[model samples]
Target: MLTGGPLDVLTGDYLAELTMLILGRDRLRNPDLGYAKTFLRQLEEGLGLAHERGVRIVANAGGLNPAGLADAVRALADKVGVPVRVAHVEGDDLMRLGAAEVPEVPEGPGEGLPAGASGEALAGAWAGALTANAYLGGAGITACLRAGADVVVTGRVTDAALVSGPAAWWFGWGPEEYDRLAGAVVAGHVLECGTQATGGNYAFFTAHDVRRPGFPLAEVWEDGSAVVTKHPGTGGVVSPGTVTAQLLYETQGARYLGPDVTARLDTVRLTPDGEDRVRISGTVGEPPPDTLKVGVTRVGGWRNEVVFVLTGLDVEAKAELVREQLADALAGAAGVSWTLARTDHADADTQETASALLRLVVRDPSPDRVGRELTGAAVELALASYPGFHVTAPPGPAQPYGVFTSALVPAASVPHTAVLPDGTRLRVGGGAGPGTAAPHDPRLPAGHGTASGADPLPGPGVEPAVPVAGGGGVGGSPAGPPRHDPTTRAPLGLLAGARSGDKGGDANIGVWVEGDAAWEWLRDTLTVEFLRRLLPETAPLAVTRHELPRLRALNFTVAGILGDGVASGHRFDPQAKALGEWLRARHVDIPTRLLPPTPEGNHP
Candidate 1:
């Protein structure tokens, strides 16, 4: 982006929940190999150009070891003859602490934790955790920048911190500047995932060119608002819809809590600014909570799977027979799950088309139990199994999987240190002000301590009722009268767009629509009860709904849906990336006015 546009800083995010676990394992084998190696390779090619253009770099490529990565970067710069000052943020690791020293989990919004999610549980996890890193704010990065560092490497700071830290340093923003800081947080969120804000994985991807979407950049101003855009002639297009879609990805509730600030997502306003540019403004901010979220990961157990293909006649009968056979073989397994996918036709043309798959997944604490023993059983069945018995691939030995969980620690407890280029260690304070505390206003929702026992909405500033364009009552929709507009049963995607993702063991699906009429209809129609009917799996889980009327969006969070986060492989869609698409595919009664015009015989 620096070569393509007038950029002052370049940030790269190369860490995720799974990456931390992988890096932790890397450190176990070799202490010097914990950071992302790909980042070093990228720097070898781009560092010179970045330094020549006076563009500073910031990244969270230092997965489990920031200091080690910092030294590596300095060595690479020296080898390439680039005199760039590199700094790193540390002290996020909590693995050194004993179980008794682990802090309790904080209670508030954004934490849609499942049952048994408590401080005691977190402490127990910490005792056996392979990796425990606190999610720090941007204060350390700011300290590094103020110390004249050209490159900043962080361990596990919030993803948005990359953009906010740079914006704070450039604008000289103080901790008390919550509104401006919050604006930077929103902008940072839009750009954190790189191409997502520019149309990658967008619900309406077919509406624009996204084959090779370019990375996104935010032009953050002094007041904290930013213009999200990419370089000229980039592959993707940026508009209100794209930006809004990104704003909702993997996020819960309207009050997006962070270490730096609590950004009011409901107050955010998006406007088009020419082509491939969207103006993001009006995002209010509140003081951050007094605690920091810490992500703890550990090896849960060994897991293995095998897929059996049954083609042609009696697919269901064939699947049942295999299930009965495997039930005895896997009886010794700690946990076993089976899924049958009938992808066959009665009078099919090709062998591939007339096939069904029966998958068996087994988990156990012992590698031998879930590995060779299970694989041997499945392989032995190849000769005695039903007709047309074939497997997709030979089942391999079981692999160790990781489990992710979150804990909260007092902000003052965890040290935030910045090792500057001059070998000077600087202590960075928390972003919350001296007397600031988590809000407990009665007007706030239930999770925030409201006394009315009413359902909790995310954050504050939620109006008692959403106002409709035409004269009407209140609440989710206009109560005065119901419009008897002609309706057709069609996919919900026809009128609304959705984005879903995982956060630890929980998953969030943010759904939105354009136009006031559509919003009114959606907000009223898609309630928790209705959603349970549409997606049966969510029926038994704890789901919370929050409204962002300003954005015409409703976000639903399902706790325990992902079963111990992405690494556990608990469900078919472990990350729930396509959960929204599944919802959109379910047929629902839709107002004809909300459906987009389409060519005859073509579905919307």
Candidate 2:
């Protein structure tokens, strides 16, 4: 599929937060076994096409051993006879600096640790301090490309850096080109996760054939304006909805922070350029931050969990019974947490309705507490507890948890070095210059309009709409069918599509509509309080909502919901990956006209 051509660069992201911790652990045991071995398999199969078509390849497959990966690639190139010039980027690892040198080590539970977890609880989390790698920028990549390398492998570079580096190198963009860099950042971000920019994980899955979605490509120009597109006859559809979904994925606040420059996502404009092509423009870029982010992983403690199944009448009683039994079985433990989820419906339906689950979790620094004792306590009640006593599954053995700690290091402190195919090493200064660019104006080119003047916030204009009092629905000039009474209730997903994710301990949900009438209805209906009403779980939480009128979207940030992000969150859907879908499933009153027309000419 990659051989179809029509691309300047092909980038792959092979490392993630958890993947880094896992690889670092492996590296501590065997120095040469840290790199992603899958890269070798992929290179062996695809390097020939990449070399033949002259498509530059960049990837961050060098987890903790870029040097070893480079050596392996050299030997593989010889065997394959591809003459591939492979170069690797290094200098993001900070483990050698020791724990004392690290600053702002996240105290307690927040970004990486479990919420309300004590500092001593996570002392074991940092068990084998291997290599703490910082997220590097695109400078190293441009260096390798400039050094005449075809393949550039890196360790701990930001995912988007793969695209940003290639775009920066191809366009000859300097460090001070903030707006252009921001544009490239948007392009890189969209393409970093491959098919995400296409239609994978899209809200409107039925709208396109996503079974075999194609990889996306960014046709970037010197001006930093790029059209996000995929190859012809691809399975996925790329409209404003898909593009907006990808833009809102895993983002925090208005600023999309990166090592190269801070890209203001609010100023971005997504215009449809024919089919399967979205033009990304007007992304304001500011000067890069002085420091780069570093991720450190430590062994926290051992944790184990078991689920008690409650069925039929007195489900609550059944859950309480199990809790009492476990409390007596294992009295001495660091902590024991329990949550009962009522999966049962109101009506007496299938046997599945009797499937409410009561989950019990035990965590301690001592393996014995979380392992045999934790599982044994639950197992002891298998024949002695509640009516129709049964467990969802057998409680598994305890596992050591790793606490991911983050820090910021001076960009200059870490000297990024690029090793070429010929073993010639060159120093690559990280990040860009400190020149701040003006705000982006959608009406004009970024940094060219009123940005230098008093009005620096030149983003999209907020739309004016009257908020309806009861439920949601607006009183305005009807653009679609005549306004119908919003007295009837329907699923919110009928009119809107949403995408959500976690940021640290918080969760962000972006909900959007396609039509003007729907947009007006959503603006008035999907308020913060109303959303809380729909999802009672968020009722007690602090939620802030931001409106993006240009995209007809509403972004809600719910704090402390994920309980210190994905790694430690206790929620069934950790990281809030299904948060948007869950919100969409909530029923809300909607106007008949706002609802889609069925084949029988009735509102769906």
Candidate 3:
């Protein structure tokens, strides 16, 4: 992109919950191998070009070792004959806090750690934690940029910091410029996921050529608003629908808390600027919580799984027989999970089509329990099981998986530092004020807490109304009953687009439509109760519904849906990447007027 378009700064995000654990393991094996090696390779090819073009590069590819990665970058610059000035932000690592000093894991909305876990359990987990890094904000990165660093790398900063940091530096935004900072934060979020803002993973992806969706960029102004667009001639698209989908991805409630500022998601407005460009404006911001989120990763336990193919007739009977036979062997395991996927068809079909799969997953602290014993038991059934007995693959030894938990600590307690290109370390402090643990805004009504079932925050341009007995309002406003328009039972995707993703153990599904009528219908119809009925897995979990009226969208956050975050592999879709698509596929009584016109000029 440096050569493709005019740019002042370029940023890359390469870290995730699982990646942090992997990097922690890498550091244990080799002291200097915690950063992303792929980033180094990319720099070898592009660093010279970026320097020649005077484009400052910011990336959180530093992973667990920003200092080490910074050194690596300097060495690569010398080798490539590029005069690049590199800096890194650090002070995010918290392993220095001994197990006894480690704080108890928080169990708020998106936090992945098990709720009500005992102190002893937390201590044990902390003692063995592979990593415990606080999520730092953009101040450190801004400091690095202002200090004349050509390249800035960071460890465990919020992903959006990659953009916000540069924008802050460029615009000279003060720490208290809540509105402007909030705008930058919103833009940062849209750009942080790379191609997602450009239609990758969009519910209506078929509408565009995403075969090679180009990365997205934001043109931020001094006032903090931005126009999200991609380079010309690039694949994929950047429209209001696409931008709205991204805005709702993995976020919960009206307040999107970050280390810097809490952005009001409900206040965000999106408008079409031009072809392949969406203007983002009017975002409200509030002071961030006094605490910072810390992610702690540890080897949870060993896990093993086996998939049994039950073919042709009596698939259920075959599955039951196998389950009964292996009951004794799996009884000793700490946790055993079974799933029966009936991907079978009756009469006149191919073998694959007529087969069902019964999968068994076991987890235990002892490797032998989940590995040797379980694998042996499953293998023994191969010869003695029901007719047409076959396994998808031979069961392998159990592999250790990580669990990610979140905790909050006073922002003042964590030191944020910037290592300059001149080898001077600068301490960056939170300029927002005294970092004392503050209660959530009490003015924010009850059921507005972090869990599922939380009420939507009042949205911009939406007036308060009496709560109706059933879901029929905007922002829980009593907008009366459903419209008396003709309706058709169809997939929700026919009238709306969606984007869903995992946030630790929780999953968020943001569904949106294009017109006012559709938005009103969606906000009134897709309540927490209705959602639970559609996706039964969410019935028992806490679900929060957030309305973004201006964006014509509703965001639902399902807590504890993924158990212990993506690293735990708790569900088939561990990261909940396709949850929105699943929701969109479910049939709903969509208003006929809201549906798009077919080629025959009729709504399907």
Candidate 4:
């Protein structure tokens, strides 16, 4: 869930380990650093809090740079006057996987610029390596836990381990409790990565002083269920708006097939007990298919890149000439991925079209010929440059870098561990039992208010319910309008799900329940007591949806469950699963479906 980044590095307190893997093309902000460190800080803080609370912590914050990061945590331990143990998950950086080790990786077609492209390479080497990172798992973390280290730092462990490790720490739950582990995994997915649930990206549509939204805080009970909440006073809100946003991001819209398991997002209830508290609860799910999709990157081949600017000549013609030149130089060599793009403005700067700027990107993972072929780009660019000295030029290749993709590895190929660093792992004298390092100063950083912990804060006014959505045992269709008033229905909304829809395609649904009765309670059963008892502590999704008239049918033009990404391969979040299971057991069937995809359209 977290990769190295500023916000993440702070979580080193409690995290026992981390999975810092990066794929070919991803938009994760901290793929190189930010989020990675956040998870690390989680372990550090968690362990620090746990140590104070008398618990152990283990984590893998090591992303692109493990040694440097490990050294950083070691420093924090020194500052806190505690010993920190860092176990490095060695040997998985895919940057080393090259053409020899990975045969399938393509030998790039090193194409150059048409006329003008980019600046020069600071340095020159051989091949070009695509994105690469290791997929270290829980084993090394187990070593850290056993090593008597209060904290553990790792590189590229799976994202779920953030929460899953804690499940292992507290419950001694094995892989058999995969579902439970999955619950914690989802918990991490919601909290650890997003930084603060409601305050983070999810708050985009709503207006709240993000001046400094409350940093997320997770309340982990002995039972192993964690509720995600932020210090209340901080300007941002954690309503259904944000939590649902996190649920859909980068998820490829598949709710069932999540990262670790084909999870099940069941019973989900979001009850705003007071001003800021929203409770999220639920279940994880079934094992994924036998083979996990593995991406391997070795030194594939070499790549030569060049930039060029075209002027006077037609843009298309210049691009064609560059392509033909590179093709001849490649001499029938297998072409890898290569891209030629317009770097600068295509239109004339001030007046009529005089010139255009462009960039050419080429890559081939072929080791032997791949390296030799890489120069093709620079050569072609050099050739083009002779004709128009006006055309700009870019740099050459770097060390031979190539990544190979791997697939279908047996589950056993990777190891699993829910290891905790050796320590008291809990609080000294206490009420809820403190976590590592004297509970991490429990210091509610500035704007964020602490959880009055002394006594329950006085309850606020009636619940501020949003819209309502009904989807339960009723075979994917929405149930008829409930037996409650539209105005106060939300007030009585025991359980409901809602998400706004933008202009046509951009429309979205953040909530999707497993059973109808669950959806019913969400939409029709809001009361003080219901808010208190029924609501969960984490995944506190506050928004609710009620189907409007014309949109009542609830499916896209094509039939499917939730057109919103929730029902896709992504699993039902813990809150939904937990709430859903309870309803399914009750066997209450609301009489409608949500997005039942017709037999022909494969939407769902």
Per-candidate TM-scores read 0.91, 0.85, 0.90, 0.47
The lDDT-based order of candidates, best leading, equals: 1, 3, 2, 4
Q: Which tens-of-lDDT digit does each residue in 315-345 have in candidate 1?
A: 8888988888877778888889888888887
Residues 1-604 of candidate 3 have per-residue lDDT tens digits of 8777888899999999999999999999998888999999998989988988899999999988999999999999999899988999998887855544544443331233464554455455456789988899999999999999999999999988888889999999988887788899999999989999997887777667889999999999998899999888889989887788888888875667888887877678888898999899888766776567788899999999999998999888999999999999988899999999999999836999999999888999999999989989888987899999889999999999889888765576577899998989998875343333334444333343222334543322122242212232223433567778889898888887888888888999988887787877887788878888889999888776766666777788788999988988899899999998888889988878877875321221
lDDT, candidate 4, 239-265, per-residue tens: 544554444332322223322444333
551 in model 1: Cα distance from truth in Å? Answer: 1.2
After TM-score superposition, the amount by which residue 55's alpha carbon in candidate 2 deviates from its true location, in angstroms, is 1.9
The list of candidate 2 runs beyond 4 A from truth reads: 98-131, 345-350, 432-487, 598-604
TM-score of 4: 0.47
What local lDDT does model 1 show for residue 593?
A: 85
lDDT of 3 at 383: 86
Clashes (candidate 2): 7
State residue 100's C-alpha deviation in candidate 1, in Å: 8.0
**Worst 10 contiguous positions by lDDT, candidate 4:** 427-436
Q: Give me the candidate number with maximum lDDT.
A: 1
Better of 1 and 3 by TM-score: 1
Which stretches of candidate 4 lie above 4 Å from their native place? 1-57, 62-149, 154-156, 171-180, 196-215, 220-226, 231-237, 250-262, 266-278, 287-295, 311-313, 325-327, 336-357, 365-393, 408-604
**Candidate 1 residue 366 C-alpha distance from true site, Å:** 0.6
